[model samples]
Target: MSTILFHEIVFGPIHSRRLGVSLGMNLLPYDGKLCSFDCIYCECGFNKDFRTKTKLPDRENVRAALEDKLLSLRREGITPDVITFAGNGEPTMHPEFKGIIDDTIELRNRYFPDAKISVLTNGMHLNKPEVFEALQKIENPIVKLDSALDKTVRLLDRPNAPGYSVAKQVERYKRFKGDFILQTMFVRGRFEGKEIDNTTEEEISAWLELVRALNPREVMIYTIDRETPAKELEKVPVGDLQKIAARVEGLGIQTNVAG
Candidate 1:
């Protein structure tokens, strides 16, 4: 089985396909993966594979580690383009998520005022008032909307909530009021005995309606770029992604294809 990708609390001034040179903040436990979605294409592999006894890093530890990293980068004259909250799991699920976001904002202001603060989330916790407020504070609230159909979402994202539905998530996403960046991962695959593909015309048409309703500032359409826990999946090519982007752009919503 594929394993968790990041092992440290504060990791990477790595090049991100979407966020540019980013410094990552991992609020989840370093030894395990804790997430709301069990995406077939997750780079961190399957959630069940990396369950651990390690605890989630506290707000104080996250703040201190981030500050230390920022100070070190400053001393070395290295400036990152963004401070990203993405690691082994759903970052907003952190118990003190709002406080952590506040701490991150303060650190960003002190160390790299020009750097954008971004949170890459699966959009599960947006129903919570505090999560919504915290996401609003970030420069890039890149929320996921992999599929518009509830059946497709169940197959593609495999959300942890027993009663999770696409309609409810769309309503939660509307709370952003065009302030958030909409991210979609297009792929084709088979999980268990079922075939899965979200790049179909029917799927894209339904998705376009949701994009229209949400009116996001930007739409990021991309495909699988790394080894996934599910070995049967196939990546959507750049040409196809560009074609999808064109269709989305036709709706008057700016779209970027990460290929």
Candidate 2:
């Protein structure tokens, strides 16, 4: 029952454990959450609890607000390391996501040319040509792949699409051609009385196979850092995360651990 929501279209220059000084861009509604996957560990809380009247912010408003914030920061002699697309929910769900990305890049060039643009997505929309193309344009396109097993993925991510499968998602990620960063959240817990732990030997073995296949620029291994909707879930320790990273690094893929 712990729920947290970002209340503005443009919020935060918060220090990200992985991405560093990031200014967030929320394409979803400011008052509610809208996402393709209802993840068990989502800090924003369950989608059912966040129903609201507010609509997704349009491209124009997002551009204006972001520019204003960047200009103000510039005046104060501050520049974020990254302009991140993350907030209440899935950012690519926006109708004009590609165009908004275009606008963001333009603004970044005009203001903070050295800053990187990153999108923290679930990778469900990569099937769409536009979404895929827009993602390719960004500096850091971090996509999620919680587990390689279909059953474990369902238990962990709870993607809204019943037809969502790990094989299909892995294939979609393949389309990126090693240009994206793969972000996996490792957690152990029970949902509805069934025990769930994606950090097990079987799960990690299957997941490492997919990681090797993808050959991403980098692999980000992390655990829950805040209150989750599913209260039974537990964070993986830094030592364990380092072990996981070592295994991943053995595959010749660089890994970053956020524990």
The digit string of per-residue lDDT tens for model 1 on 202-257 reads: 99999999999999999999999888899899988899999999988998999988
Top model by lDDT, which number? 2
Quickly count the clashes in candidate 1. Answer: 0
lDDT, model 1, position 183: 97
Question: Candidate 2, residue 50: CA error in Å?
Answer: 0.7
Per-residue lDDT tens digits for candidate 2, residues 53-129, read 79788889999999999999999898899999989999999989999999999999999999999999999888889
Model 2 poorest ten-residue lDDT run:
1-10
TM-score of 1: 0.98
Misplaced by over 4 Å in model 1 are none
